[model samples]
Target: MSHSVAEHEPAEVTESGNANGAGIDLKWLSDRVEYGLYQDCVHCGLCTASCPTYVMTGDENDSPRGRIYLMRAVVDGRASVTEKVRHHLGLCLDCRACETACPSGVQYGKLIEPFKVALEISADGDDRPPLLLRILLRHLFPYANRMKWALIPARIGMKTGLIPIARSLGLTKLLPKTLQRMEEMLPPSMPLLPPAPLPEKLEPVGKKRATVALFTGCVTDAMTPETNSATARILQHNGCEVHVVAGQACCGAVSYHSGDENGAKAFMRANLNAFDLSKYDAVIINAAGCGAMLKDYAHLMHHDPEAARAAAFTAKVKDITEFLVELGPVKPANRVEAKLTYHDACHLCHGQQIRNQPRQLLGMIEGLSIVPLEETEICCGAAGTYNLSQPEMSRRLGRRKAEYIDATGASVVAVANIGCQMQIRYYLDERGGSHEVVHPVELLDRAYGPLPGGTA
Candidate 1:
């Protein structure tokens, strides 16, 4: 298929879905996505080798170049937003693997994210996310406090072994498809109660090299609180004063990716007002997805008056490993002698171009063995809420990842994102493998020492 799209013909569109037009103001796409981003694709097909959907489906429409063609065609009046077109676009993981693969430096996220927002607004009733999922994604997932309440039942089930009994009796099959996927992905060892909050301020263990603010994420903070606390303790151990900024909220990734653009901006704006950027040397994020979103805030609101402030904020954002490596980490004295393989979270590796800092941090652990897992950079089918939306494909990729992890014979798999952690854990459990998935900093914290004040 030809990848290049002709210039959009605005004269052809009408206000209604008449014989004259599809009622789509395709010109609006020009506002959200620059036309040059579409033209950047040369259609060399190099990206197809890296795309998770294309690799799985072996369909041209599922490939990055093909999706670009479809999106550009729709904008240029060569095509319409048909169900088939939505299927091709919706199947995408938005993991940005294609961006890393493209020689032309095609900004695929700039193209696809706007298109997702457009589809969510314009799609027919049956084509949108289900009502319950809408509530969960928009209402519950972005709110850490709300999510803790929601997980209470699951925590109880896991604590009492009722979850295992329920699965044995096929009782889990009765849940809504989304809930079933959520249930499947819940880590078995979740605590009976929600995790404790990070202290307002943690003093540096010695002379402070840097004062940093921690962006404890919404889903990540609720799901893996230890990792958040570990991140704080690790920063402190490395001679950085860590502060959990108050009134902070989600990074707007969950809402933005789920197609609530206005709501996402609201969250972003709230964060802008919350964090006093001058006091901290840098803003630290442990989760790659949140880091990428926080870093891209400047681009997301380029036209607004607050764009300059967003850009300034973005300048200070860094992933925990990236910051620690740049800050010259203290050599860990304690030994954690576990053979582990690292799974590169898509957002960290591709979205943020962070491939080696994590491995570098892991290398410092005194007695750790680092083995290369096959297909380490491949998406593990947990691109944000992807497990809920595309469970079948999610499972396929999850199982595929699990197989590679198993082949390594490593007892543990370390990942940098909450979504990847949960998805990998679920699939490894399904395949009856006993691999433990953990954040890299958790190990670093273990090697360093315990927190100064108390346990989180």
Candidate 2:
């Protein structure tokens, strides 16, 4: 392993990484990370109640303040980066809820993200995630077409009931542990077909209000195609000329969060060159994770030579709901009569500070009642790939979220991210609850009228 805590004794470490010149690349821990970030935490417990992991475990080390302290200690050479420390940090959802909860305005993402990247750089053969899952995460997920092709077999198995039959026969247990966890998280009855891709162009129904490029990132595109189609239709209904730009790849969130920074950068660069900012008023994204990642392009590429372009690209990025609200969305004339509650995707509400825009849009549908969900801001254990990596905690939080949604007495639940929708639906199904978890845009699309290829 590149980083072994046992080899280094306690010593005064400086902002300049690896002052003692150990075998580790301590520069990973220091470079691009401001030393002052650790100072922003006032040790206040205000964020704990809001932290999903802390609320679930009641472990101080699982809390943001505690994790910050751990990373700082390891960097300062006052403490070692033991396996326990790694576990504590790995458990983080990176939902950025702490940023919203912190009064002193701590940039927790800046600190935690770098530290996780450093761990990836330092980890050895034995320290990495499962080999099979790692390959899928690295080689498959960031590529949309590859993911769609890869899921074809699984979709067939699902349609034929072979997947459930295998589970019943205990055949799936012979598979890799990571795959087993993923299967457990699948919706009770997985869909047979992916959503149809959006056309390159969709003209406004009445008069043009805005022109936007829709971002259909990898996982969301492969897993929830209908949501993407709905988002495009909704944008069109709102008097916006929508373009599904060519050459746009995954938003790099999967790679970045998986600790492949350079790979993430490549995806980001591809997206940067894909969209002509001059042609579009704003780059719209339905998935909250992809939206946050797209909007943070400036921060991610700050050190790159093309920083200006990244910032320019980021400046025009907006969540679909945010763009609609700012554009003064036209109210849908058709009624979508249903009682549902909105479960705030952590990235949309906390990461991007987009709390009200979704509900505001949902409120516009006639005869639609938007009920309040308890602990709506809490992460639903679908923090990117957390459910696969940390199955136990993920299940606990997923079940917790399902319970809260069940208590809402609503038949449908709206979520901004595909991950949340999948997790919630799985848990709801596991509990034998008949709840339809859907993207808010899907409902809006219904309100507007029939979809492009499907009936209302």
- State the lDDT of candidate 2 residue by residue for 90-189, as single tens digits: 8999989999998889999888887887887777776788888789889998888997887887888888999989998999999888888777656555
Q: Count clashing residue pairs in model 2.
A: 0
Model 2, residue 212: distance off in Å is 0.8
In terms of lDDT, the best-performing candidate is: 1
The numbered model that scores best in TM-score is: 1
TM-score of candidate 2 versus the correct structure, residues matched by position: 0.92
Show model 2 residue runs off by greater than 4 Å.
Answer: 1-24, 187-196, 451-456
Candidate 2, position 128, lDDT: 83
Off by over 4 Å in 1: 1-25, 452-456
Residue 330 in model 1: lDDT = 92
How do the residues 41-117 of candidate 1 rate in per-residue lDDT, one tens digit apiece? Answer: 88787888899998898777788988888777777666677777778888999999999999999999999988987
TM-score of every model versus the real structure: 0.95, 0.92
Predictions in order: lDDT = 0.87, 0.84
